[model samples]
Target chain A: MQVPAPFDYKRASTLAEAIALLRECGPDSRVIAGGHSLLPMMKLRLARPEVLIDINHLSELDYIKVDGNTLKIGAMVRHVTLQKSHLAAEYYPIFAEAEEQIADPLVRNRGTVGGSLCQADPAEDLSAVFSALKADILIAGSYGTRKLPISEFHTGPYTTALNPDEILTEIDVPLRSNTGSAYEKVERRVGDWAIAAVGTMVRVDDGLISEAGIGLTAVRADHFRAKEAEDSLLGRSPSTEAIAEAASLAARHCNPFADQRGPEDYKRHLVEELAKRALSRALNRSLPEVH
Target chain B: MRVNMSVNGVEVSDEIEPRLLLVHFLRENLRLTGTHWGCDTSNCGTCTVLMDGMPVKSCTVLAAMASGSQITTVEGLGANGELDPVQQGFIEMHGLQCGFCTSGMMLSARWLLDHNPNPSEKEIREAISGQICRCTGYENIVRSIKWAAAHSQNSGVQQGVEA
Candidate 1:
């Protein structure tokens, strides 16, 4: 039977209390929201934190709303909420799409967006989706709150830029008009981690691509994004040829490792194919049909 | 730590270790073995139970985190010694062969039918996709959930008999 090693558990009633607990528990402590990712790791002895501060009772950090031109999502928002949120689907379809593919419904009910992003698994879907949207993450520490671009959030696999005493509070996604996004993933089975997944967002203006964002997962795209591909799509029409070129650039840039999921070359192929499919769908949504 | 929670509508309190999983808390501590534990990882949904009316894999949840929540196991599905519609439907449709996955499947079906009275075949399949039945009796399971959806309004007093 798999079980976590004995540790002290602390439940924080408020955000301030949670922060204080984190500081008091010191560096060997960790904050748990959903505990889906953390508990499993604990069982395997992969993550042996001396103290676990449960933040589920902090209802203040569970929300999805619009503030001016930005869509703000609280860190404690569960994956099920994101998947079922009509507002999320309307503004960022990639979130709903990716949330649907994250684990299963049972897991989604308890798994929080904050935990997923903080876990920083290379195969995690939300990281790619947020990376494509160029979202900013809000972190709170004893000192104060700080915002970090999603690109700089992940320092490495299973790691984040968050300090030991800090907690990620919210995600800020800049809303854009005439923008459409889509996520495409290829998993071996239902609820499995992606072999390779791509999330694409496009902003079309006057029949030209004003801006584009391409994010890849599992295939290990640098910073979870394809900067060269995104740059190539800028100022270009969303034609099949232009999209193919950008997709090729995206495939060439990612560094996938060979594993039980697939070989490195197969993952590279999936990156190219999924990127093309995601870009096509995103462009279709951004531009009105001529016919 | 001292944990207090409602299980099957009964208020219970106990002193438990922080590392104790909810599945163990239910099975060993509370002696509610109806909620089966399978594939300690969250992949298999056999350990599923209703927490605040939503289905959650109990194996992945710490008992400490569920201290104040209301949990409904398969044993709580029926009241006054009557079977829940889901339990009756499982018998009527032969939803189980080995019956290892029956409890979790029935609880999930009950939650789904409560939220969506009439789910399509695809929806029912999707609802139980997290559960793994080695007997490969998913067709009967789908039919069982559909049967429950149809008979949900009826008072389910009939005794459940395996087919």
Candidate 2:
């Protein structure tokens, strides 16, 4: 067994303290919320920080609140909570469906949404879902706080745009519009990491496509929008041919890697199939009259 | 750090490293070895234990974070040197050949029954998907969970198995 390197451990009772510690420790201290991703990386020697500042004890950061126009989820909210939340099921049911398909119940119970995003494993399922949902990440720093769109937050594989002195505090997702969203994934086996996953959110107005956002995961270095596919569907009533064409375009945009799961070309093919299926489902549910 | 939590109905307060996983705290510090550690990667639920009545992989949970929480290991279920109904059901159903994954299977089953009393086969399969038992091929373990869920409560001390 590979043990983690020796590190200083600190507990923060408040978000202010956590941010302050991040500023003070700079590059050495890592904020640990659930440790579902970071701890495993630490054990594998992929990450070896000088300090582990635990934010799990900060009870103030564990809540799921539905404000007037947005649903705000604290950074420490576990994936299981999001999966089982009635609010998520009512407002953002697609996220619930995606959460249900994550690693498994044990990882879901301990993994936090913010940590998953911050870890920025490009192939992360929830990251793509949130990116397609137009979620905002609330980050706290020594200066104050700032929010960034999920699209702009994740920079690359295992990297985020967050400054070393910044810590993510909450994830704010907008309430659904006259829209329907769907998440579809292709994995090597049940309960295994996804080879490629697609999350499509479509907003329809009077049998016409008003807006569309498509996010792809595991097929690229980072979760990215399939703007070409979205562009193809805009202002048109989606048909089988159009959806298939858009999916093919999405396939062309992916940068999949040949891994133990599948070949890069196969992963690209999966993205196309998954994107087509997900977009069609979203279109059907969002614009039933047109379908 | 000084940590305080209840394990197996006993309140424990001890000093521990913040990076120490709850499984190590329970097994090494508290000397509760019933909770096995199969894969520390959190892939296998062998280190599963009930934290605040919810089943979680102890290897992923920090001992410091578990402070002030209520934990129940596999040892907490039995009574008077006997096996719990779930444990006995595994024995009766031949759920184990090597017995390495028994504790995780039992705790997972216990948590499943607590949330869902009469689970469908799909739900049962989903509940224990986190646990991996290479010994029994999981057929008998599923059957054992079903049997324990069906017969244990309604039987009311019918001389089948005592816990």
Candidate 3:
């Protein structure tokens, strides 16, 4: 019989109306998109906002499209939509793969991208996926819109750089040619949070690694990324030895705490193994096939 | 606040508190107990209902958010006193032992059949992955969904039970 503490609820029919309500409600107010993450927190008394601005009616913020070299995704886009989007699969298969592993279908139907990123749970899969993709997020406020790289969005666990009055409206992912990405997670069960997950993106140029991004989640990796691993793979051929060394670097850089999931050493070991597998798969996908 | 929505093709309105969850609203206010409430968290699918023709965990959704939206519960599955193919399949294939997870499972199966008429066993399992049946009756549940897919067109006609 869990119920949220008493609070005033207001539904905003438009984005402008929502921003107006946010400005009026002040910092004690919070915007709820899907209510999957926020409501559960409210039930536990972890989050007790005085006012909840429901933004589900702002359907204008729900879309997935490719413009120029960027794949722009609306904040209101649900997890199920991303998992089923052919455009997302073609450009970055990591999104679809990670979406499939984020909760189950019932939760996916209502869980929005904005809500997930805003929640900023350390174990959330999309944060790692977007971090690996080096995406940018658009935050809309009363004044105007501002864009911030996903790496700079999160300041701490369950915290984002978003101001109380600002609403995240869109996620922008840059599309790269001859690049491949993959997400690997080790969850205790189907819908459980990851013990340690790794998302890797690799771009090969002329048989050398031009760029690489390795993002880790649930392991307390700084900035939710493995910069040491990324630097180790740059300007080098993604050979077996290079990949193994880079995976070890990712494992060495993480700081996982022991909990019900497993001990710290075990999670760090998973970070190493999963990072290696993701890097290997990404490299395989990036390289052209030889007949 | 006043929330108005369509439940099972019927328009309904209620003056519910903003904190009222859609699950409690359905059971307490509207007396639609067919939508079971289990595991207040979104882990269990027993509280699942169709919101705009897609299955969503009702426990996590506020009734206020459902305003002007269409919701379909197990009570709305069959029409004219006839069972939906999913309902009949459950009965014939013994998809339930305790029957606590029946409504959610049947509704999810119905959604899957509507979208994909010929889903394999793996697909059926994946479709209902969110649902939890403590009775461990998943084998028959899979078979029940298959039965509905096999007899989707003429669910009214009873077919001979296979030996």
DockQ, all models: 0.80, 0.53, 0.83
The sequence of per-residue lDDT tens digits that candidate 1 reaches over residues B97-157 is 9888899999899988878777889999989988888885699999888888877773231
- Candidate 2's C-alpha runs over 4 A off are A221-223, A288-291, B80-82, B154-163
TM-score of chain A, every prediction, order shown? 0.98, 0.94, 0.98
The best candidate in terms of DockQ: 3
Model 2: interface root-mean-square deviation in Å = 1.7
Model 3, runs deviating above 4 Å: B154-163
Higher TM-score: candidate 1 or 2?
1
> Candidate 3 on A1-291: residue-level lDDT in tens?
999999999999899999999999999999999888999999999999999999998889999999999999999999999999999989888998899999998888899999999999999999999999999999999999999999999999999999988999999999998899999999998788999999999999999999999999999998899999999999998799999999999999999999999999999999999999999888988865831
Ranking by DockQ: 3, 1, 2
TM-score of each: 0.97, 0.94, 0.97
Expressed as tens digits, the lDDT of each residue in B1-163 for candidate 2 is 7999999889999988777889999999999999998788888889999998888888888887789899999999878997777888898899899888889889988888777766677887888888888888889998888777776664423333554
Better of 2 and 3 by DockQ: 3
Query: What tens-digit string does per-residue lDDT give for candidate 2 at A115-203?
Result: 98899887788888887787899998888889999889988888998888888888998876678888998776556889889988888
Q: Please give the distance, in angstroms, between residue A130's alpha carbon in candidate 1 and its true position after superposition.
A: 0.4
What's the residue-level lDDT of A73 in candidate 3?
97
Please identify model 1 stretches exceeding 4 Å from their true place. A289-291, B154-163
